[model samples]
Target: MEMIVSFILAIVSYMLIDNVVLSRFYGICSFIGVGNKVKSAFSMGLAVTFVIMMATLVCYPLYFYVLVPAGIPFLDTLVYILVIASLVQIVGLFIKKTSPSLYKTLGIYLPLITTNCAVLGVVQTNSDSQLDFLTSLANGLGTSIGFLVVIVLFACMRERLNGYNIPKAMKGVPIALIVAALMAMAFMGFGGMVG
Candidate 1:
Protein backbone atom coordinates (compact mmCIF):
# COMPACT_ATOMS: atom_id res chain seq x y z
CA MET A 1 0.00 0.00 0.00
CA GLU A 2 0.97 3.63 -0.41
CA MET A 3 1.04 4.10 3.33
CA ILE A 4 3.44 1.25 3.76
CA VAL A 5 5.79 2.73 1.18
CA SER A 6 5.61 6.14 2.81
CA PHE A 7 6.32 4.60 6.14
CA ILE A 8 9.34 2.84 4.71
CA LEU A 9 10.62 6.04 3.19
CA ALA A 10 10.03 7.88 6.44
CA ILE A 11 12.05 5.32 8.36
CA VAL A 12 14.83 5.37 5.81
CA SER A 13 14.90 9.14 5.89
CA TYR A 14 14.98 9.37 9.66
CA MET A 15 17.59 6.66 9.97
CA LEU A 16 19.94 7.80 7.23
CA ILE A 17 19.05 11.38 6.39
CA ASP A 18 16.89 13.21 8.91
CA ASN A 19 18.41 11.84 12.07
CA VAL A 20 16.95 13.60 15.10
CA VAL A 21 20.27 14.39 16.77
CA LEU A 22 22.58 14.83 13.82
CA SER A 23 20.19 16.23 11.26
CA ARG A 24 17.56 18.09 13.27
CA PHE A 25 19.64 18.59 16.42
CA TYR A 26 16.70 17.59 18.61
CA GLY A 27 18.44 15.63 21.39
CA ILE A 28 21.92 17.09 21.38
CA CYS A 29 22.43 16.28 25.03
CA SER A 30 22.40 12.52 24.59
CA PHE A 31 23.95 12.79 21.15
CA ILE A 32 27.03 14.39 22.65
CA GLY A 33 26.96 12.86 26.12
CA VAL A 34 26.49 9.20 25.20
CA GLY A 35 28.45 9.24 21.97
CA ASN A 36 31.84 8.56 23.49
CA LYS A 37 31.84 4.91 22.39
CA VAL A 38 29.96 2.70 20.00
CA LYS A 39 28.47 0.56 22.73
CA SER A 40 27.18 3.48 24.74
CA ALA A 41 25.95 5.29 21.68
CA PHE A 42 24.10 2.19 20.51
CA SER A 43 22.43 1.88 23.87
CA MET A 44 21.46 5.53 23.88
CA GLY A 45 20.08 5.33 20.37
CA LEU A 46 17.99 2.26 21.15
CA ALA A 47 16.77 3.82 24.35
CA VAL A 48 15.65 7.00 22.63
CA THR A 49 14.08 5.10 19.76
CA PHE A 50 12.17 2.82 22.09
CA VAL A 51 10.97 5.75 24.16
CA ILE A 52 9.97 7.79 21.12
CA MET A 53 7.97 4.96 19.62
CA MET A 54 6.18 4.32 22.87
CA ALA A 55 5.45 7.99 23.38
CA THR A 56 4.00 8.40 19.91
CA LEU A 57 1.82 5.34 20.26
CA VAL A 58 0.28 6.73 23.41
CA CYS A 59 0.25 10.45 22.70
CA TYR A 60 -1.28 10.42 19.23
CA PRO A 61 -4.60 8.84 20.18
CA LEU A 62 -4.90 10.96 23.30
CA TYR A 63 -4.52 14.10 21.26
CA PHE A 64 -6.82 13.17 18.41
CA TYR A 65 -9.76 11.28 19.89
CA VAL A 66 -9.64 12.43 23.49
CA LEU A 67 -8.25 15.91 24.01
CA VAL A 68 -9.39 17.47 20.77
CA PRO A 69 -12.86 16.04 20.85
CA ALA A 70 -13.30 17.00 24.48
CA GLY A 71 -12.43 20.63 23.73
CA ILE A 72 -9.42 20.39 26.05
CA PRO A 73 -6.89 20.67 23.26
CA PHE A 74 -5.03 23.35 25.19
CA LEU A 75 -3.97 20.74 27.70
CA ASP A 76 -2.42 18.51 25.07
CA THR A 77 1.07 19.90 25.38
CA LEU A 78 1.24 19.28 29.10
CA VAL A 79 -0.51 15.96 28.87
CA TYR A 80 1.78 14.68 26.16
CA ILE A 81 4.91 15.57 28.13
CA LEU A 82 3.51 14.00 31.25
CA VAL A 83 2.68 10.81 29.40
CA ILE A 84 6.10 10.63 27.81
CA ALA A 85 7.92 11.28 31.07
CA SER A 86 5.84 8.75 32.94
CA LEU A 87 6.35 6.14 30.25
CA VAL A 88 10.06 6.75 30.17
CA GLN A 89 10.33 6.34 33.92
CA ILE A 90 8.34 3.14 33.85
CA VAL A 91 10.45 1.78 31.03
CA GLY A 92 13.68 2.80 32.72
CA LEU A 93 12.67 1.03 35.90
CA PHE A 94 11.58 -2.03 34.00
CA ILE A 95 14.83 -2.14 32.10
CA LYS A 96 16.87 -1.62 35.23
CA LYS A 97 15.13 -4.46 37.03
CA THR A 98 14.90 -6.85 34.10
CA SER A 99 18.30 -6.33 32.57
CA PRO A 100 20.96 -5.22 35.00
CA SER A 101 23.69 -5.34 32.39
CA LEU A 102 21.76 -3.12 29.99
CA TYR A 103 20.88 -0.88 32.88
CA LYS A 104 24.53 -0.49 33.80
CA THR A 105 25.51 0.16 30.23
CA LEU A 106 22.72 2.63 29.64
CA GLY A 107 23.28 4.19 33.03
CA ILE A 108 22.12 7.80 33.13
CA TYR A 109 21.21 7.89 29.47
CA LEU A 110 18.03 5.99 30.19
CA PRO A 111 16.78 8.72 32.47
CA LEU A 112 18.17 11.46 30.27
CA ILE A 113 15.84 10.24 27.54
CA THR A 114 12.81 11.34 29.53
CA THR A 115 12.99 14.87 28.16
CA ASN A 116 14.49 14.20 24.77
CA CYS A 117 13.00 16.47 22.12
CA ALA A 118 13.17 13.77 19.47
CA VAL A 119 10.65 11.71 21.40
CA LEU A 120 8.41 14.70 21.95
CA GLY A 121 8.81 15.75 18.38
CA VAL A 122 7.49 12.45 17.09
CA VAL A 123 4.50 12.57 19.38
CA GLN A 124 3.64 16.11 18.40
CA THR A 125 4.09 15.41 14.71
CA ASN A 126 1.97 12.30 14.79
CA SER A 127 -0.79 14.17 16.53
CA ASP A 128 -0.66 17.09 14.13
CA SER A 129 -0.60 14.87 11.07
CA GLN A 130 -3.64 12.89 12.28
CA LEU A 131 -2.07 9.64 11.19
CA ASP A 132 -4.00 6.46 11.96
CA PHE A 133 -2.62 4.00 14.50
CA LEU A 134 -0.85 1.82 11.98
CA THR A 135 0.71 4.78 10.22
CA SER A 136 1.78 6.25 13.51
CA LEU A 137 3.48 3.01 14.50
CA ALA A 138 5.25 2.92 11.18
CA ASN A 139 6.34 6.48 11.63
CA GLY A 140 7.61 5.75 15.11
CA LEU A 141 9.54 2.74 13.87
CA GLY A 142 11.05 4.79 11.06
CA THR A 143 12.09 7.63 13.32
CA SER A 144 13.74 5.23 15.74
CA ILE A 145 15.65 3.60 12.94
CA GLY A 146 16.81 7.00 11.79
CA PHE A 147 18.02 7.92 15.25
CA LEU A 148 19.73 4.59 15.69
CA VAL A 149 21.52 4.76 12.35
CA VAL A 150 22.80 8.29 12.86
CA ILE A 151 23.98 7.78 16.42
CA VAL A 152 25.89 4.65 15.45
CA LEU A 153 27.40 6.42 12.48
CA PHE A 154 28.36 9.36 14.67
CA ALA A 155 29.94 7.06 17.23
CA CYS A 156 32.14 5.55 14.56
CA MET A 157 33.06 8.93 13.20
CA ARG A 158 33.91 10.22 16.65
CA GLU A 159 36.10 7.19 17.26
CA ARG A 160 37.99 7.89 14.07
CA LEU A 161 38.24 11.60 14.83
CA ASN A 162 39.92 10.85 18.14
CA GLY A 163 43.19 10.18 16.36
CA TYR A 164 43.09 13.23 14.13
CA ASN A 165 45.05 16.43 14.56
CA ILE A 166 43.12 19.68 14.39
CA PRO A 167 43.57 23.35 15.07
CA LYS A 168 43.31 24.35 18.71
CA ALA A 169 40.25 26.49 18.04
CA MET A 170 38.42 23.55 16.51
CA LYS A 171 38.99 20.97 19.21
CA GLY A 172 36.46 19.08 21.29
CA VAL A 173 32.86 20.17 20.78
CA PRO A 174 33.84 22.50 18.00
CA ILE A 175 35.30 19.67 15.93
CA ALA A 176 32.39 17.45 16.77
CA LEU A 177 29.97 20.10 15.63
CA ILE A 178 31.86 20.53 12.40
CA VAL A 179 31.78 16.80 11.75
CA ALA A 180 28.08 16.66 12.56
CA ALA A 181 27.35 19.51 10.21
CA LEU A 182 29.17 17.68 7.45
CA MET A 183 27.23 14.56 8.20
CA ALA A 184 23.97 16.48 7.91
CA MET A 185 25.08 17.86 4.62
CA ALA A 186 25.80 14.37 3.37
CA PHE A 187 22.35 13.24 4.49
CA MET A 188 20.78 15.88 2.26
CA GLY A 189 21.61 13.64 -0.65
CA PHE A 190 18.65 11.51 0.32
CA GLY A 191 16.12 14.31 0.11
CA GLY A 192 15.50 13.85 -3.58
CA MET A 193 15.11 10.15 -3.19
CA VAL A 194 12.42 10.24 -0.51
CA GLY A 195 9.45 11.32 -2.57
Candidate 2:
Protein backbone atom coordinates (compact mmCIF):
# COMPACT_ATOMS: atom_id res chain seq x y z
CA MET A 1 0.00 0.00 0.00
CA GLU A 2 2.79 2.41 0.86
CA MET A 3 4.59 1.53 -2.30
CA ILE A 4 1.46 2.12 -4.28
CA VAL A 5 0.97 5.51 -2.70
CA SER A 6 4.56 6.44 -3.35
CA PHE A 7 4.21 5.31 -6.92
CA ILE A 8 1.14 7.43 -7.43
CA LEU A 9 2.74 10.44 -5.83
CA ALA A 10 5.84 9.96 -7.88
CA ILE A 11 3.82 9.89 -11.07
CA VAL A 12 1.82 12.96 -10.21
CA SER A 13 4.88 14.85 -9.09
CA TYR A 14 6.70 14.00 -12.26
CA MET A 15 3.79 15.08 -14.38
CA LEU A 16 3.13 18.37 -12.65
CA ILE A 17 6.80 19.23 -12.29
CA ASP A 18 10.37 17.90 -12.43
CA ASN A 19 10.33 17.42 -16.19
CA VAL A 20 13.51 16.24 -17.88
CA VAL A 21 14.07 19.12 -20.24
CA LEU A 22 12.93 21.74 -17.79
CA SER A 23 14.11 20.37 -14.51
CA ARG A 24 17.23 18.43 -15.37
CA PHE A 25 18.17 20.16 -18.60
CA TYR A 26 18.40 16.89 -20.47
CA GLY A 27 17.25 16.64 -24.11
CA ILE A 28 17.69 20.38 -24.60
CA CYS A 29 18.43 19.74 -28.24
CA SER A 30 14.88 18.66 -28.91
CA PHE A 31 13.36 20.78 -26.19
CA ILE A 32 14.67 24.02 -27.64
CA GLY A 33 14.86 23.08 -31.30
CA VAL A 34 11.68 21.10 -31.89
CA GLY A 35 9.44 22.97 -29.49
CA ASN A 36 8.29 25.82 -31.66
CA LYS A 37 4.56 25.13 -31.62
CA VAL A 38 2.17 23.76 -29.06
CA LYS A 39 0.98 20.91 -31.23
CA SER A 40 4.33 19.67 -32.41
CA ALA A 41 5.87 20.28 -29.04
CA PHE A 42 3.16 18.29 -27.32
CA SER A 43 3.61 15.50 -29.81
CA MET A 44 7.33 15.42 -29.25
CA GLY A 45 6.80 15.38 -25.50
CA LEU A 46 4.38 12.47 -25.75
CA ALA A 47 6.76 10.64 -28.02
CA VAL A 48 9.67 11.11 -25.65
CA THR A 49 7.62 10.01 -22.68
CA PHE A 50 6.40 6.97 -24.56
CA VAL A 51 9.94 6.02 -25.45
CA ILE A 52 11.21 6.49 -21.91
CA MET A 53 8.47 4.45 -20.27
CA MET A 54 8.67 1.68 -22.83
CA ALA A 55 12.41 1.55 -22.65
CA THR A 56 12.30 1.39 -18.87
CA LEU A 57 9.72 -1.39 -19.03
CA VAL A 58 12.13 -3.43 -21.10
CA CYS A 59 15.38 -2.44 -19.41
CA TYR A 60 14.52 -2.95 -15.73
CA PRO A 61 13.85 -6.66 -15.84
CA LEU A 62 16.92 -7.22 -17.94
CA TYR A 63 19.02 -5.40 -15.41
CA PHE A 64 17.55 -6.94 -12.24
CA TYR A 65 17.34 -10.51 -13.50
CA VAL A 66 20.19 -10.84 -15.93
CA LEU A 67 22.87 -8.20 -15.72
CA VAL A 68 23.23 -7.53 -12.01
CA PRO A 69 23.05 -11.11 -10.86
CA ALA A 70 25.64 -12.11 -13.39
CA GLY A 71 28.29 -9.92 -11.75
CA ILE A 72 28.42 -7.81 -14.86
CA PRO A 73 26.87 -4.64 -13.56
CA PHE A 74 29.45 -2.74 -15.53
CA LEU A 75 27.72 -4.04 -18.61
CA ASP A 76 24.49 -2.40 -17.53
CA THR A 77 25.18 0.86 -19.38
CA LEU A 78 25.86 -0.99 -22.62
CA VAL A 79 22.97 -3.40 -22.26
CA TYR A 80 20.47 -0.71 -21.36
CA ILE A 81 21.57 1.46 -24.26
CA LEU A 82 21.36 -1.44 -26.68
CA VAL A 83 17.93 -2.46 -25.42
CA ILE A 84 16.56 1.06 -25.56
CA ALA A 85 18.04 1.74 -28.96
CA SER A 86 16.63 -1.46 -30.40
CA LEU A 87 13.21 -0.91 -28.85
CA VAL A 88 13.02 2.65 -30.14
CA GLN A 89 13.96 1.49 -33.62
CA ILE A 90 11.37 -1.27 -33.57
CA VAL A 91 8.67 1.06 -32.31
CA GLY A 92 9.55 3.78 -34.79
CA LEU A 93 9.35 1.36 -37.69
CA PHE A 94 6.06 -0.05 -36.48
CA ILE A 95 4.53 3.40 -36.10
CA LYS A 96 5.77 4.48 -39.50
CA LYS A 97 4.12 1.56 -41.26
CA THR A 98 0.93 1.46 -39.26
CA SER A 99 0.10 5.16 -39.19
CA PRO A 100 1.25 7.23 -42.06
CA SER A 101 0.16 10.56 -40.60
CA LEU A 102 1.85 9.88 -37.31
CA TYR A 103 4.86 8.64 -39.20
CA LYS A 104 5.02 11.93 -41.02
CA THR A 105 4.68 13.98 -37.86
CA LEU A 106 7.09 11.99 -35.70
CA GLY A 107 9.35 10.39 -38.28
CA ILE A 108 12.09 12.95 -38.27
CA TYR A 109 12.37 13.04 -34.48
CA LEU A 110 12.07 9.32 -33.83
CA PRO A 111 15.65 8.57 -34.61
CA LEU A 112 16.85 11.40 -32.41
CA ILE A 113 15.05 9.92 -29.42
CA THR A 114 17.24 6.84 -29.46
CA THR A 115 20.20 8.81 -28.16
CA ASN A 116 18.44 11.36 -25.97
CA CYS A 117 19.98 11.62 -22.54
CA ALA A 118 16.55 11.99 -20.96
CA VAL A 119 15.64 8.46 -22.03
CA LEU A 120 18.90 7.11 -20.69
CA GLY A 121 18.44 9.09 -17.49
CA VAL A 122 15.16 7.35 -16.73
CA VAL A 123 16.71 3.93 -17.14
CA GLN A 124 19.67 4.83 -15.00
CA THR A 125 17.45 6.21 -12.25
CA ASN A 126 15.30 3.11 -12.24
CA SER A 127 18.31 0.83 -11.98
CA ASP A 128 19.91 2.83 -9.21
CA SER A 129 16.69 3.31 -7.26
CA GLN A 130 15.93 -0.43 -7.13
CA LEU A 131 12.27 0.32 -7.60
CA ASP A 132 9.93 -2.60 -8.12
CA PHE A 133 8.47 -3.18 -11.54
CA LEU A 134 5.30 -1.31 -10.76
CA THR A 135 7.12 1.56 -9.12
CA SER A 136 9.50 1.75 -11.97
CA LEU A 137 6.56 1.89 -14.35
CA ALA A 138 5.04 4.64 -12.30
CA ASN A 139 8.31 6.50 -12.17
CA GLY A 140 8.80 6.24 -15.89
CA LEU A 141 5.28 7.42 -16.58
CA GLY A 142 5.72 10.29 -14.16
CA THR A 143 9.05 11.25 -15.62
CA SER A 144 7.57 11.24 -19.10
CA ILE A 145 4.72 13.43 -17.98
CA GLY A 146 7.24 15.80 -16.53
CA PHE A 147 9.03 15.88 -19.85
CA LEU A 148 5.77 16.56 -21.67
CA VAL A 149 4.82 19.35 -19.34
CA VAL A 150 8.10 21.13 -19.80
CA ILE A 151 8.14 20.70 -23.55
CA VAL A 152 4.66 22.06 -23.90
CA LEU A 153 5.39 24.95 -21.59
CA PHE A 154 8.54 25.83 -23.47
CA ALA A 155 6.70 25.64 -26.75
CA CYS A 156 4.03 27.95 -25.49
CA MET A 157 6.61 30.41 -24.29
CA ARG A 158 8.41 30.30 -27.58
CA GLU A 159 5.18 30.91 -29.41
CA ARG A 160 4.47 33.91 -27.25
CA LEU A 161 7.91 35.31 -27.88
CA ASN A 162 7.65 35.10 -31.63
CA GLY A 163 7.04 38.84 -32.08
CA TYR A 164 9.04 40.16 -29.21
CA ASN A 165 11.95 42.40 -30.06
CA ILE A 166 15.11 41.05 -28.54
CA PRO A 167 18.72 42.16 -28.39
CA LYS A 168 21.13 40.36 -30.68
CA ALA A 169 23.17 38.96 -27.83
CA MET A 170 20.15 37.72 -25.86
CA LYS A 171 18.21 36.26 -28.77
CA GLY A 172 17.59 32.65 -29.74
CA VAL A 173 19.37 29.97 -27.74
CA PRO A 174 20.51 32.27 -24.98
CA ILE A 175 17.02 33.42 -24.17
CA ALA A 176 15.77 29.89 -24.41
CA LEU A 177 18.44 28.78 -21.98
CA ILE A 178 17.47 31.50 -19.57
CA VAL A 179 13.84 30.51 -19.78
CA ALA A 180 14.76 26.89 -19.19
CA ALA A 181 16.88 27.81 -16.21
CA LEU A 182 14.06 29.78 -14.70
CA MET A 183 11.72 26.89 -15.33
CA ALA A 184 14.10 24.55 -13.56
CA MET A 185 14.11 26.82 -10.57
CA ALA A 186 10.34 26.74 -10.56
CA PHE A 187 10.32 22.97 -10.57
CA MET A 188 12.63 22.93 -7.60
CA GLY A 189 9.61 23.80 -5.50
CA PHE A 190 8.27 20.29 -6.13
CA GLY A 191 11.56 18.63 -5.34
CA GLY A 192 10.89 19.35 -1.71
CA MET A 193 7.80 17.21 -1.82
CA VAL A 194 9.55 14.05 -2.90
CA GLY A 195 12.49 14.74 -0.65
Candidate 3:
Protein backbone atom coordinates (compact mmCIF):
# COMPACT_ATOMS: atom_id res chain seq x y z
CA MET A 1 0.00 0.00 0.00
CA GLU A 2 2.74 2.44 0.86
CA MET A 3 4.51 1.71 -2.41
CA ILE A 4 1.34 2.26 -4.37
CA VAL A 5 0.70 5.52 -2.58
CA SER A 6 4.22 6.66 -3.24
CA PHE A 7 3.88 5.86 -6.89
CA ILE A 8 0.65 7.79 -7.12
CA LEU A 9 2.16 10.79 -5.40
CA ALA A 10 5.18 10.71 -7.70
CA ILE A 11 2.92 10.76 -10.73
CA VAL A 12 0.82 13.62 -9.41
CA SER A 13 3.83 15.62 -8.35
CA TYR A 14 5.69 15.33 -11.64
CA MET A 15 2.63 15.54 -13.88
CA LEU A 16 1.06 18.59 -12.21
CA ILE A 17 3.25 20.29 -9.61
CA ASP A 18 6.62 19.92 -11.31
CA ASN A 19 5.79 19.84 -14.98
CA VAL A 20 8.86 19.91 -17.24
CA VAL A 21 7.73 22.62 -19.66
CA LEU A 22 5.48 24.71 -17.43
CA SER A 23 7.17 24.31 -14.05
CA ARG A 24 10.80 23.55 -14.87
CA PHE A 25 10.75 25.66 -18.05
CA TYR A 26 12.47 22.93 -20.08
CA GLY A 27 11.55 22.41 -23.74
CA ILE A 28 10.07 25.89 -24.05
CA CYS A 29 11.36 26.29 -27.60
CA SER A 30 9.13 23.65 -29.10
CA PHE A 31 6.43 24.43 -26.57
CA ILE A 32 6.06 27.91 -28.03
CA GLY A 33 7.24 27.33 -31.58
CA VAL A 34 5.00 24.42 -32.57
CA GLY A 35 2.20 25.18 -30.13
CA ASN A 36 0.25 27.45 -32.45
CA LYS A 37 -1.52 24.39 -33.87
CA VAL A 38 -3.10 21.70 -31.74
CA LYS A 39 -2.36 18.81 -34.07
CA SER A 40 1.27 19.70 -34.38
CA ALA A 41 1.58 20.28 -30.66
CA PHE A 42 0.12 16.87 -29.96
CA SER A 43 2.51 15.21 -32.38
CA MET A 44 5.50 16.97 -30.87
CA GLY A 45 4.34 16.00 -27.42
CA LEU A 46 4.10 12.31 -28.37
CA ALA A 47 7.50 12.38 -29.99
CA VAL A 48 8.98 13.99 -26.92
CA THR A 49 7.29 11.48 -24.65
CA PHE A 50 8.60 8.57 -26.66
CA VAL A 51 12.12 9.86 -26.57
CA ILE A 52 12.02 10.56 -22.86
CA MET A 53 10.77 7.10 -21.97
CA MET A 54 13.17 5.23 -24.19
CA ALA A 55 16.09 7.39 -23.21
CA THR A 56 15.35 6.91 -19.56
CA LEU A 57 15.24 3.15 -19.98
CA VAL A 58 18.63 3.21 -21.67
CA CYS A 59 20.31 5.96 -19.68
CA TYR A 60 19.45 4.84 -16.17
CA PRO A 61 21.22 1.53 -16.53
CA LEU A 62 24.16 3.01 -18.39
CA TYR A 63 24.71 5.58 -15.68
CA PHE A 64 24.58 3.18 -12.77
CA TYR A 65 26.09 0.06 -14.20
CA VAL A 66 28.68 1.46 -16.58
CA LEU A 67 29.57 5.01 -15.58
CA VAL A 68 29.53 4.55 -11.86
CA PRO A 69 31.65 1.44 -11.92
CA ALA A 70 34.07 3.06 -14.32
CA GLY A 71 34.40 6.17 -12.09
CA ILE A 72 33.51 8.34 -15.04
CA PRO A 73 30.35 9.97 -13.80
CA PHE A 74 31.38 13.24 -15.41
CA LEU A 75 30.57 11.76 -18.79
CA ASP A 76 26.90 11.33 -17.92
CA THR A 77 25.73 14.50 -19.62
CA LEU A 78 27.64 13.68 -22.78
CA VAL A 79 26.49 10.09 -22.77
CA TYR A 80 22.88 11.00 -22.09
CA ILE A 81 22.91 13.47 -24.94
CA LEU A 82 24.18 10.82 -27.30
CA VAL A 83 21.54 8.36 -26.18
CA ILE A 84 18.74 10.87 -26.66
CA ALA A 85 20.06 11.99 -30.02
CA SER A 86 20.27 8.47 -31.34
CA LEU A 87 16.79 7.62 -30.07
CA VAL A 88 15.34 10.70 -31.68
CA GLN A 89 16.93 9.75 -34.98
CA ILE A 90 15.39 6.29 -34.85
CA VAL A 91 11.99 7.71 -33.93
CA GLY A 92 12.24 10.30 -36.68
CA LEU A 93 12.92 7.65 -39.26
CA PHE A 94 9.98 5.57 -38.01
CA ILE A 95 7.67 8.55 -38.13
CA LYS A 96 8.90 9.50 -41.57
CA LYS A 97 8.31 6.06 -42.95
CA THR A 98 4.94 5.49 -41.25
CA SER A 99 3.36 8.95 -41.47
CA PRO A 100 5.02 11.33 -43.84
CA SER A 101 2.35 13.93 -43.12
CA LEU A 102 3.25 14.00 -39.43
CA TYR A 103 6.89 14.11 -40.41
CA LYS A 104 6.20 17.22 -42.48
CA THR A 105 4.04 18.78 -39.81
CA LEU A 106 6.65 18.20 -37.18
CA GLY A 107 9.40 19.35 -39.50
CA ILE A 108 12.35 20.84 -37.69
CA TYR A 109 10.65 20.66 -34.35
CA LEU A 110 10.86 16.89 -34.49
CA PRO A 111 14.59 17.05 -34.88
CA LEU A 112 14.75 19.71 -32.18
CA ILE A 113 13.85 17.04 -29.64
CA THR A 114 17.46 15.96 -29.95
CA THR A 115 18.49 19.02 -27.99
CA ASN A 116 15.39 19.49 -25.87
CA CYS A 117 16.54 20.17 -22.35
CA ALA A 118 13.47 18.44 -21.01
CA VAL A 119 14.74 15.10 -22.30
CA LEU A 120 18.14 15.65 -20.76
CA GLY A 121 16.48 17.00 -17.66
CA VAL A 122 14.50 13.81 -17.17
CA VAL A 123 17.58 11.61 -17.47
CA GLN A 124 19.63 13.86 -15.22
CA THR A 125 16.87 14.04 -12.65
CA ASN A 126 16.58 10.29 -12.50
CA SER A 127 20.32 9.92 -11.98
CA ASP A 128 20.46 12.70 -9.40
CA SER A 129 17.44 11.46 -7.50
CA GLN A 130 18.74 7.87 -7.61
CA LEU A 131 15.25 6.59 -8.12
CA ASP A 132 14.60 2.88 -8.65
CA PHE A 133 13.56 1.81 -12.11
CA LEU A 134 9.84 1.86 -11.36
CA THR A 135 9.87 5.34 -9.84
CA SER A 136 12.02 6.63 -12.66
CA LEU A 137 9.59 5.23 -15.19
CA ALA A 138 6.75 6.92 -13.35
CA ASN A 139 8.58 10.23 -13.38
CA GLY A 140 9.33 9.97 -17.10
CA LEU A 141 5.74 9.13 -17.97
CA GLY A 142 4.32 11.82 -15.72
CA THR A 143 6.64 14.46 -17.07
CA SER A 144 5.76 13.61 -20.67
CA ILE A 145 2.07 13.58 -19.86
CA GLY A 146 2.47 16.97 -18.26
CA PHE A 147 4.17 18.24 -21.38
CA LEU A 148 1.40 16.87 -23.58
CA VAL A 149 -1.30 18.39 -21.40
CA VAL A 150 0.10 21.92 -21.33
CA ILE A 151 1.11 22.19 -24.99
CA VAL A 152 -2.28 20.94 -26.20
CA LEU A 153 -4.15 23.29 -23.91
CA PHE A 154 -1.97 26.20 -24.94
CA ALA A 155 -2.52 25.39 -28.60
CA CYS A 156 -6.29 25.42 -28.11
CA MET A 157 -6.11 28.79 -26.41
CA ARG A 158 -3.91 30.18 -29.16
CA GLU A 159 -6.36 29.00 -31.77
CA ARG A 160 -9.14 30.90 -30.04
CA LEU A 161 -6.96 33.95 -29.44
CA ASN A 162 -6.25 34.13 -33.17
CA GLY A 163 -9.95 34.77 -33.71
CA TYR A 164 -10.04 37.55 -31.15
CA ASN A 165 -9.34 41.17 -31.99
CA ILE A 166 -6.39 41.95 -29.80
CA PRO A 167 -4.18 45.00 -29.53
CA LYS A 168 -1.66 45.40 -32.30
CA ALA A 169 1.19 45.51 -29.82
CA MET A 170 0.16 42.30 -28.08
CA LYS A 171 -0.04 40.19 -31.22
CA GLY A 172 1.86 37.00 -32.08
CA VAL A 173 4.78 36.03 -29.84
CA PRO A 174 4.13 38.81 -27.34
CA ILE A 175 0.66 37.57 -26.53
CA ALA A 176 1.92 34.02 -26.52
CA LEU A 177 4.59 34.93 -24.03
CA ILE A 178 2.03 36.63 -21.82
CA VAL A 179 -0.21 33.59 -21.97
CA ALA A 180 2.73 31.31 -21.18
CA ALA A 181 3.57 33.40 -18.15
CA LEU A 182 -0.02 33.30 -16.94
CA MET A 183 -0.12 29.55 -17.44
CA ALA A 184 3.09 29.17 -15.46
CA MET A 185 1.58 31.18 -12.64
CA ALA A 186 -1.56 29.07 -12.73
CA PHE A 187 0.51 25.89 -12.53
CA MET A 188 2.08 27.30 -9.38
CA GLY A 189 -1.08 26.50 -7.50
CA PHE A 190 -0.27 22.82 -7.74
CA GLY A 191 3.02 23.33 -5.94
CA GLY A 192 1.47 23.46 -2.51
CA MET A 193 -0.51 20.30 -3.10
CA VAL A 194 2.58 18.30 -3.89
CA GLY A 195 4.77 19.93 -1.30
Model 2 over residues 1-195: C-alpha lDDT tens digits?
A: 987788888787666656666666678788888856898888788789889978987898899999888988778888888988998899898998899999887888898898788899889888887878887887789878877878888888888888999888999889988888887788777766765
Which residue pairs clash within candidate 3? Answer: none
Model 3 TM-score, 2 decimals: 0.91
Global lDDT of each candidate: 0.79, 0.82, 0.88
Error of 3 at 179 (Å): 0.6
Better of 1 and 3 by lDDT: 3
Worst lDDT window (10 residues) for model 3?
102-111
Total clashing pairs for each candidate: 3, 0, 0
Q: Give one digit per residue, the lDDT tens place, for model 1 in 1-195.
A: 987777777677656666676666787766766655998888888888788878887888788889988999888779988998999889988988899888897767877887778888777777777777877776678778877877888889999988788898998888888888898888877766766
User: What does the lDDT come to for candidate 1?
Assistant: 0.79
Ranking the candidates on lDDT from highest down gives 3, 2, 1
Residue 89 lDDT in model 2?
A: 90
Q: Which lDDT value does model 1 have at 42? A: 89
